[model samples]
Target: MTGRFVLQNVKTINGIAVDIILENGKIIEIVPPGTGIGDKIIDYKQKVFVSSGWIDLHVHAFPELDPYGDDVDEIGYKTGVTTVIDAGSTGADQISDLVSSYKNSKTNVFAFLNISRIGLKRIDELSDTSWLDEKELKKAISQYGDFIVGLKARISKSVVGPNGIEPLKIARKFSADTGLPLMVHIGSGPPDIREVLNLLEQQDIITHYLNGKANNLFDEKGEPLPEFNKAIERGVHLDVGHGTASFSFPTAEVAKKRDIRFNTISTDIYRGNRLNGPVYSMANVLTKFLYLGYPLKEVIDAVTVNAAVWLRKPELGRISVGDIGNLTLFSIEDESTLLQDSEGEKRMAEKRVVVKGVVINGEFNEC
Candidate 1:
């Protein structure tokens, strides 16, 4: 059975108007205005905006957990997000369940192999030497390497404490040995932000790149940390993982003013923050960034092509011909808004962008 769908006359952030055609779960063509017909047509009438489907690279959703507790499929299906990479919410022991049960049954899911055995539950330090099993980690990745995209380690002050840089050292070694990218959660670490960032190799990701707090990308002089610039120079990826306790207006504003371009934009969504303030949806994240001076096309790329590049899954993010039919339709709303970051700084936006529908694998799912 062939399923046909068309999105007509939608404006792109790049000032292009086209009709996108989806057939049998793949994008068949994108024709300039007045050129396509399909079984189903959505005439956006220039009112809707189009972009590549979003890929949230640093989410905390898991399938086995409650719908509220890190459920990847629920969030992805509901938020116009066709794909998401769970940022190390499940460790070696729990990955088997994820691969067998959740990975096969839900919205596209990928995971960063948590360095800890128990994952992020009931424990603060993931570097517990006793539970650190290299053998098990290797086995999990070897068995389920496709779904296991990379490694996740939270290098924050409250999480890692004053353990020096041993945890980071271990995570670095793991990434190096496995030949996979490292998704490092950066925020409040004690080893000085410079030292921690220096360890990140090329292609490694530094999430929460714009968190406003002590031990962040800024120094007392309000200039970016030396190592942060160094990492960028070395081609290290910067990711905006706006979590409940991450992302501040001060940080975002400063980064934007400095013209620091993030390699990717993502939501560090979890059970608690899904319905709360700043964590509404990826479109909201896009809106905040747009207000912060990033061009709309660049903002779209942050959540789409840029994120997919980091995951090494290039086909999942773009809407090019022959690619899976992952599409997002949005509208720009005129309004005044106040957004709060983790540090409680308030920022205002004059408009908000809202998603109208998502098409994943050519299947229509309206949100």
Candidate 2:
């Protein structure tokens, strides 16, 4: 029920204690601890931290695809993520089905329309040039409008096959025509990472930037490549997709040492990675960042404010009066936890971020 409720004595990431009053799915007031009153009072007593709901910028939410699909809520609010962006799990041919599938879901869902008409029905979606149907792609974007946030092109070796950099070139043109940003997945590449980075304009995202693949953004010395620096200067966004095969602890360590940071932290998560190694949940992925020596605020912001700002939905990034009551309640537990990256490297974290519950659509769901 979208009832009046008071989340009392909850702490912000900055450690400020406050009471949040939510009514009819909107935040009515944020007051001093113990001051706000409502019909339903759920007091955290300053033990829980609240922030704008977590937004996963990259996920596979089309449950039909075998290797790269999942139920929306399975990776969303159930795991402290109130919103998820399906990262091109479907394209023109199947985006409608993907959209229809999530209509009854509690989690807020969006998608990046794949340039290929077939999408991830097969991993090498971009291998066929015929699947890059501009007409159908345009039609899907026009039909979905805002529901389709941007375009996603997996411009790696396996996904692109012998087509090389051609798919990305078309994707760039599509981005220009549609006025949408591109979220490009990078991995082992014969198209060459430099060519991919060169094609991306300002605001295009490079997911899996820290992957330890030979064709990664960093050089052999763990220093950023000239093209990578150029891409950063062009305002290309870096994302930590952290898929089952992406994300390397050593690569991440190098990035941390060199001060290379992610604009958004996402799990290129599907059923395999979520239930197996590496990316288990949003909290699990955040914990790895914590182990990398990032502060709680920066790590949390990667999934919250940073993602929201990129999505052009600033209202989803902060808690304020008159905004929708979308938030995640979590805590830092001082317990030793073992974390593993995609490379099978392990690190022991002394502290972990744990999700307690989430407030979405004016209703609270305990994790």
Measured by lDDT, the strongest candidate is 2
Q: Candidate 2 — worst ten consecutive residues by lDDT sum?
A: 1-10
Tell me each candidate's TM-score: 0.94, 0.99
lDDT of 1 at 188: 68
Could you give candidate 2's per-residue lDDT for residues 1-367 as a string of tens digits?
A: 4589899999999999999999989999999999999998989989999999999999999998898899989999999999999999999999999999998899999999999999888999999999999999999988999799999999989999999999999998899998999999999979889998888888999999889989998888888988999899999999999999889999999998888889999998998898986899999999999888899999999999999999999998999999988899999999999999888899999999899999887788889
For model 1, give the RMSD to the true fold.
2.1
Candidate 2 similarity to native, TM-score: 0.99
How accurate locally is residue 286 in candidate 1, as Cα lDDT from 0 to 100?
76
Candidate 1's TM-score: 0.94
lDDT of 1: 0.78
Please report, as a residue range, the 10-residue window in candidate 1 with the lowest summed lDDT. 122-131
lDDT for each residue of candidate 1 in 1-367, tens digit (9 for 90 to 100): 2388788898777778899888998889999965779998878888888777778888877645543256666568678888888888878888877666563443678888887767776346554654557788888899989888888877876667657677888888888788988888887667678878889989888898888768889777667877788888998999889987778877777777777878898888877677775676777777888788777788888888888877777887666898877777888889897766777777789988888888876787778
C-alpha lDDT (0 to 100) for residue 331 of candidate 2 = 94
Best candidate per TM-score, number? 2
